[model samples]
Target: MPNAIQDQEIAMLRSELEMLMKEREALLRVAGYAAGFIAELDSFDVPRGAMQAAELLAECVNGLTEETLQDALSAVQAHSVA
Candidate 1:
C-alpha cells in the first residue's frame, strides 16, 4: 500500500539524514582543528621544523574520522601540557 511505501521512504530518509549529520560533525571538528592551529601559530614564532610538523599533522588529520580527530586532539593537548 501507499502508506507502507511512505513509511519505507521515511525510514530511508532518516538513515540518510543520520549519515549527513555524522559527516557534518566530522567536517566541523576538522574546521575547529584548523582554526585552533591557525590561532595558536599566529601568536608565536614557530620554527621551520615545527611548521612542517604542523603541516604533516594536518595531512594526517584530513584522512581521519571524527573519533580519530578527538583522539589526536587529546594527544596533542597532553603533549603540549607536558
Candidate 2:
C-alpha cells in the first residue's frame, strides 16, 4: 500500500513538471519574439542614446536569469513615477 501511494505521488510530480516545462517553453518563445521586435526597432535611424538603451533592454530580456529579471522589474517599477 505504501509503495502504491509513493508511485501515485511520483506520477503526479512528473505531470506537474511537464506542465511547468511547457509553460517555460512558451515564455521563452514570447521572449524571443520580443527580442526580435526590439532588434527591428534598433535598425531604424534612432538617436544614439535611444538605440543604446534599446540594445541594453534587449540584452536584459535575452539573458534573463531569475535574479536579474527581478532586479530589472524592480528598477522599472521604481522609475514609474507618474
Give a tens-digit lDDT track for model 2, residues 1-82. Answer: 9999999999999999999987765555555555556757835677877877777768868688876455544544444442
Residue 28 in model 1: shift from native, Å? 0.4
Off by over 4 Å in 2: 42-82
Q: State the weakest 10-residue window (summed lDDT) of model 2.
A: 73-82
Q: What overall lDDT goes with each candidate model? A: 0.69, 0.68
Candidate that would win on TM-score: 2
The number of clashing residue pairs in each candidate reads 0, 0
Encode model 1's per-residue lDDT on 1-82: one tens digit a residue: 9999999999999999999987766665665566467557742587776887777766665767777666656655654577
Off by over 4 Å in 1: 42-82
For candidate 1, the per-residue lDDT at 3 reads 100
Residue 26 in candidate 1 has what lDDT? 61
